[model samples]
Target: MTTFTFHGGAGEIGGNMLLIDSPGSRFFLDFGMSFKRHGEYFSEFLQPRTSNALGDFLNLDLIPDIEGLYRNDFLSHNKMKTSEEPAFDGILISHAHLDHLGYVNLLHEKAHVYASSVTKGIAEALDELGSGSKDDFVKTTKSFSYYENKKGEISRIRNCRDPEIKYSQREYPLTVDRGEFEVGSASVQIFPVDHSIIGASGFIAHAGGRSIGYTGDFRNHGSRPELTRAFVENMASSDLDILFIEGTNIDEEKGMSETDVGNEISRLITEAEGRHVFASFPVRDTFRLLSFYTAARNAGRKLAVNFRQAFLLDKLDSNKALERGKDIIPSHDEGLSVYIKKREYGLIGEDVEEEEKARDYDKKERPYVGIDNQICWKDVRDNPGEYVLFLDNYSVQELVDIQPVEGSIYIKSQCEPFDAEMELDWGRIENWLDRFGLQVKRAHASGHMSGGEIAEVIKTIEPKLVVPMHTQRPVLFSDLCDCEVLIPEKGKSYEF
Candidate 1:
């Protein structure tokens, strides 16, 4: 018997938690946060109290009220039941996107965590960088071999966890990607897929005379389109009983291919005169970063990245698999400069002496050494035409310092508004551009399969039952696909 339930991400775009049970053991495909769940009760200032861990989540229903799967320490701290027995086998992560893996922090330490080594590495790096306030959660561990650090060679990561822990091999299971693995009665195959973010994957689960395939989040128009095709071809022979897929962009406008997006941005940057080029895309989108780098290089300008991006590139290089594929990873000399925000010691608008600023800056080793590839707002302001700046929303204030001249270019190279909050933010972004007199040009691409493209993927898989997930418009898929469509409802269990 095989049963699966959707705790979240059914009829939504983000939070994805799926629990699967075979007769002998149980496993989870993802334990990501649900935006719908988070938005319902909390606003910016109003958040769950830190003192109540499981109490807030379980009572507020952010996390499912499951037994034994939560961390014993956290549950006990919250005065909730902390079962000694294990609830399920393990968790298999599809990608490093927070919507896909944000809730992993709340899991019991004993429950196995599985993902591609690159994903684990990136997750750890993000944790180290302290993004999204995940410092308290996100316990990701990986085994790497540093045969010799004397030469400063980055260690090679071996594998991604397959949701089982064998203490005999080491204290923890090797965090590596695997081809075939077993969890009780179910045997599965993990395969890589193309995505905007690095280390995205899909998996095939086989058990109880039924075969199912799960795609975490994938796109056929990424830099590695072949990988997506390979995933489909690899599973074609299985003749799947059911297929669970994501539809993040199903109800929205179809996106452009990465190459086309690159071309559009390149043309914009190349044609701009007497002004700087500024663009903002999701920082984790590895290919988008490379595209902007290439565009800057082709335009005879250097790409300036923020402190966080520089840190990410260095961490990525430490992983052998990802490092080898990089044509240009951010560094001081690789047409990349680390944008160091001018430090202010006193309250807002309170000016300090040049000596104070210089002395305080030289005293700190954090955010990379200032002497190496570090550019301040003044340097960029002076040399506007020589640099292309990668700006995230948080760093939007740097525009006041850069003081982009009239006719300067700003490309918003990400998808359009998906929600009210996003539309509000978009308006603020345009307002910032208007305030600075920067010319706005929008050139963006999505990181998911379109309705037409998804229809073709269904044609290839040929599953008997097709369940639409990670989408708001699952009904549209029925018209797009030829297979029997199943619209998953939240917390509903289904049998195959």
Candidate 2:
């Protein structure tokens, strides 16, 4: 018999933890941390772990211990155990998204971890770019490794229960077979799927004449839509007993396709009076970048991207349009006159030469400026006409420090969480808008499928049982499909 349990990500967005046990072995799908509420987080800083780490435990109902599930002792150094300690057989990382793979480093060294080749590359790249917090839960057993230096202070945190023990580093094969792997008595396959980020995937686990499918996070459109469709069709014919799907856009009333959203953003940029600043999540979606490129080109304004965004574009050398240098602006250009926050420049790299490369442009040409917080005020005073500011969720408030003139707009080019509980800053965004008088517009499309598209996928996959994950409204499946919607509660086991 095989049993499946939902440890986290049951009815929430983050902290996606799932446990699958078959015969003598068990494994985890994902383990992530959830953001806490506003007041709760503030109180948590005053007393770490004592007060629930910003109410994440309370909000997700995670405070109460679930019977039969292992405690998250892997999160702390003091409570860590040796390899001989009880642990899962393996962990399957579906993709490189922080929410999906965040708590992965928590696994013991003896446990195996698996991901696709492309996904592994992206994950390493993220660590190189200083985005290694996703794996903070894991400890480093060796001194010489790509991630050793960065794991310095993190290794010192005290473990909760066991004071004498030290945690081991996470160990896994560089790449795993996408087709299937045996874990105890069950077989698991990794299915590639299209999403905002490259190399995202779903999973198919089969055992005892029953099969289950898990869609990590996916979209049904864009360059890889066909691949996604094919995966769905293949799963449909596999006689699967259950399917776990993601319903990220379940509550969105009127969502546009990626192509349409791109066109709309282009229109907005075309009509803008000044230079355009676009803050985007630079992932696998080249269409969004292309849309910004087209809009800037049509408006006769240079498209300026931060060093991190530029690096993302560089990694995607596969895109012919971006590679040909159509409308994209290289990071280091002198005489380029747009000001960006200085702290953001740190993402490029630590090397002084590499940092200087962004500023090394033709001095004879028009000055294109990148500004840090201290110098941004100067750029605003000197080059107000040449700048249009684009703000992401993280740096939106920086615009206030610049205080652009009336006609300038702030374009939000990503999905804003609808659930207030899930958002990090509540009402802070509205307050910022009110103070700046900057017109705010959502010029973004999701990287996940809509209700209709998810329904189409269900029909195509045709699994014996349908389950939904990574969604707030899992009940929506009741209206879309005829299969059994197995809404497993946290730690509640389902046997096959």
Candidate 3:
């Protein structure tokens, strides 16, 4: 018997953790963070205690308590029993979205991680650019261990700053080729799928003489609808015993495509000529970024992205050939510019005293400070119509410096507020826009298949059992599909 357990994503829309136990193999699908679950205990000001390590996550049921599935440093330091060998075979990550790959660094070191090359590259870039107390994704920093100082006193080893403590790089086998790979007793195959973010994939695992198909998150309305269609066609002939599908948009009947968003943005930019335009969207959604880039090019304006997006674009361009045959816009494109916001002390450029601006920005950001395509607040303010500034709510403070002209455009190209905290943030953004006399417009597309599209996919696949996940309305699957629908309860085990 093959047992399937729902540890997180069953009753929610983002936190996805599925444990698959076969006769001789045991592994997890994805170890993601559930926004709904995390919001219950932690907020913006209140965060999980780093001193407690995994204690907060474990106690709050944010992560499963399965043995031999967590990091060694955390387990031993927290006084939890340590395992000699990793309990699970491996983790197959579908994409780089936070909801799908947030908690991967917390897993056991010996367990190999399987993901696409683009996903690995994104993880590496994020880890390199991330500050605060974040551990690395490609190479995790060792934590909570102790060592003897020169004075013969015991002291806890800090992350990577200490020369003796090295970053741990685990075995992350690239699945970009979409070839068959062995995971314990199971054989797995990967397929590229369309989603809001790049490097998204679907998986099919054959173990214990049973075939299971899992869709991490997909939509047929994005720029690459053909990718989703190919996955559906392949699954239709695979004789799948069970299908695990995302139902995020299972209650909605319609969806907008990325091309549509691009057209609307072009029209808006054309109409807002001779004035500045600013937009906000998920930075990782390279397709949406490309939409804005194309729109800016058509309107004779450069798209100015923050340092994070510029860094990510450079990384993606370096690994474009490694991706699943998708071409992303190059970071060095003439129509693209890196926006360098004034850091601490409000100092930028060479004219400022070096000593005063030394502590303003991180070393990673210093390299692009004076680059040819870089733009600062003064540059944008002097030539407002020459650039389309990309600024999210977190970066809205720059508005005070740039001071966008009246009738300037502000495009919200992401999802609407899903929770109260987000609603409050949106309200704050509105206040900023209103204060600057900016005109706000929403031109975004969702990253999931709509109810009608999902129904069509279900009918085409024709699996024996349909299991809905990554959704709040799981019961709706029964009405949408002709096959047997199992609405899994959180933390329960089901067998086929």
Candidate 4:
């Protein structure tokens, strides 16, 4: 028997988790947090207490109620029953986006996690650059052997893999590959798809004689439009029984391309006279970073990024893991500079001792490697027009220090804010620009296929059953495609 369970990513934009149960295999498609559900209960200051983490989320239905899929420690802490073994064998991550891979820390220890090689490298880099908490992906360990157990006993039992900190790099479960692989009875073929992210992929999963073509999140307008085209063509020939696809931009028709955004940015920077440029984009969109990097170079200006982005770029570049266009990696380059915030006590603070620096990566020099070509806000303020700054929402606060004069430019090189909360954030961003005297400009390309584009893709593949996911209007897919559309609800199971 083959069954599909919608654990998440239903009638929403993010938080994609699903269960694929076949006679041979049981696994999850993603393990992410739903922003819509989370915002209803908690805020920045009103977060759930660590003592009641699982309880808080469970009470709100923010996470699933599966038994053997979650970590034993979390369930035990919440007074919930935990299975002695994991119910699922693994989780196949589509990409490194937070909406797709954020809740990896909640998985059972025995779960074997898989992603593309680039996705794994990006996840490791993000973990090194992200805040250290129990929810983090990479575990920090000083010793390679035994760890201090909860009971403070010297036990040498080794049976689990994750949810808790791995404590050692050797125990990290980041087994990544391309092409066909099996997780128990289920057979899966991973095809790289073009999305806003670098390692986004589509899956062709087969179990119990039923095949599912799942497009996690895809688009056809970026540096690699050909990739998506090929994926669509290939999946069309797969003769899948079910086609599961993301409809993130299904309501829209026309869309912009990455080349278009780069040309616009290049024009804006070249025409500006003595005005500094500020651009906003997703933190991990390496290609977008490179596009802005190219724009800055065209205008004869260096691109200044925050320490975290520099860490990601430096980690990816130093490892030489970026496959397609390794030369586009923007670290330790003349055109790139790390913007070190002049903080008194943060990670990049001048007062942080050499001995007390971060110890996540195997390399001893990782803590301060990317901060070598550091530039303070004052450096930018002194020579405003000499650099183009990348300051998305999180780093926008730094504008108070730089203090740009009137007529400076601000380019929002990302999608327009979608939800009410994001709309509020967009307003706040405008207020900041108003206060700082920066002229606002809009230029961006989406990471999802539009309605017309996806309709064509659906027609090409022409599967027996079509299920819309990663979109608010799944029912509308029936009108968009020629095949039978099934709008799967959250937590519902469908049999094939």
lDDT of 4 by residue, 1-496 (tens): 7888887899998899988888879988988888888888888778977666767887889888887877666677677897878897789889888788877866675567778777777878766655333444544322213455677665432422333544433123444444888878888888888888887888888888988888988988887788788888888888989998999888898678988988998999887757788888988888888888988988999888876787777666754435524324656788888776544344433345644433322352354433567676777888888888888777778888789867889988888877788899899989988988889888889998899998999999999999888999887798887788889999989998
For 1-496, candidate 3 gives per-residue lDDT tens digits of: 8899999899789899999999888888988889888988989888888867487899988999999998787788788988877898999899998888888878887778988888888888888887423545667666766677767777766633554454668689764546688889999998888889888889999988999999999998888889889988889989999999999999997867898999999999999998989999998888899899999999999999988898888888877444422447665678899988887777864476655565688888877776789888888888888999999877888888888887898998999999998899899999988999899898989999898899999899899999999999999998997899999998999989
Q: Could you tell me how far off, in angstroms, the CA of residue 146 lies in candidate 1 after the best superposition?
A: 33
Better of 2 and 3 by lDDT: 3
Give the better candidate number (1 or 3) by lDDT.
3
Worst 10 residues of 3 by lDDT: 320-329
Tell me the whole-model lDDT of each prediction, alpha carbons only.
0.76, 0.57, 0.85, 0.77
Ranking by lDDT: 3, 4, 1, 2
- Selected candidate, larger TM-score, 2 vs 4: 4
Number of the top-ranking candidate, with TM-score as the measure: 3
lDDT of 4 at 91: 91
* Per-structure clash totals for the candidates: 6, 20, 0, 3
Best by lDDT: 3
Q: Runs in model 2 with CA error above 4 Å?
A: 36-81, 129-134, 137-169, 174-185, 251-254, 275-290, 310-340, 343-390, 397-403, 421-426
In angstroms, the error of model 1 at 207 is 2.7
| Per-residue C-alpha lDDT of model 2 across residues 1-496, encoded as one tens digit per residue | 7777887777666556787777666777766544432234434244334323313443445432332222244223233223454356677787777777754543444556667665655554454454122233333222112221233533433322222233344455634425777765667788777677666777887755567777888887654577688678778877777787888776655466666766777677666666324444444344565566556656655444544454444444443323234323333432122334545343222246633735543332113333332124345534544443444556665664566666656666766656554364536776776677766666776788888888878888777777677777888888888777877576677885
Per-residue CA lDDT of model 1 for 305-358, tens digit only, reads: 877777777777666556543522745556788777755552212255544455
- Candidate 2 structure, TM-score to reference: 0.72
What are the clashing pairs of model 4? 24-185, 109-161, 109-162
Better structure of 1 and 4 per lDDT: 4
**Model 1 deviation from the true structure expressed as Cα RMSD, one decimal place:** 7.5
For every candidate in turn, the CA RMSD to the true structure comes to 7.5, 7.7, 2.1, 4.7
Worst 10 residues of 4 by lDDT: 138-147
For model 2 the local lDDT of residue 414 reads 69
TM-score list, all predictions: 0.88, 0.72, 0.95, 0.88
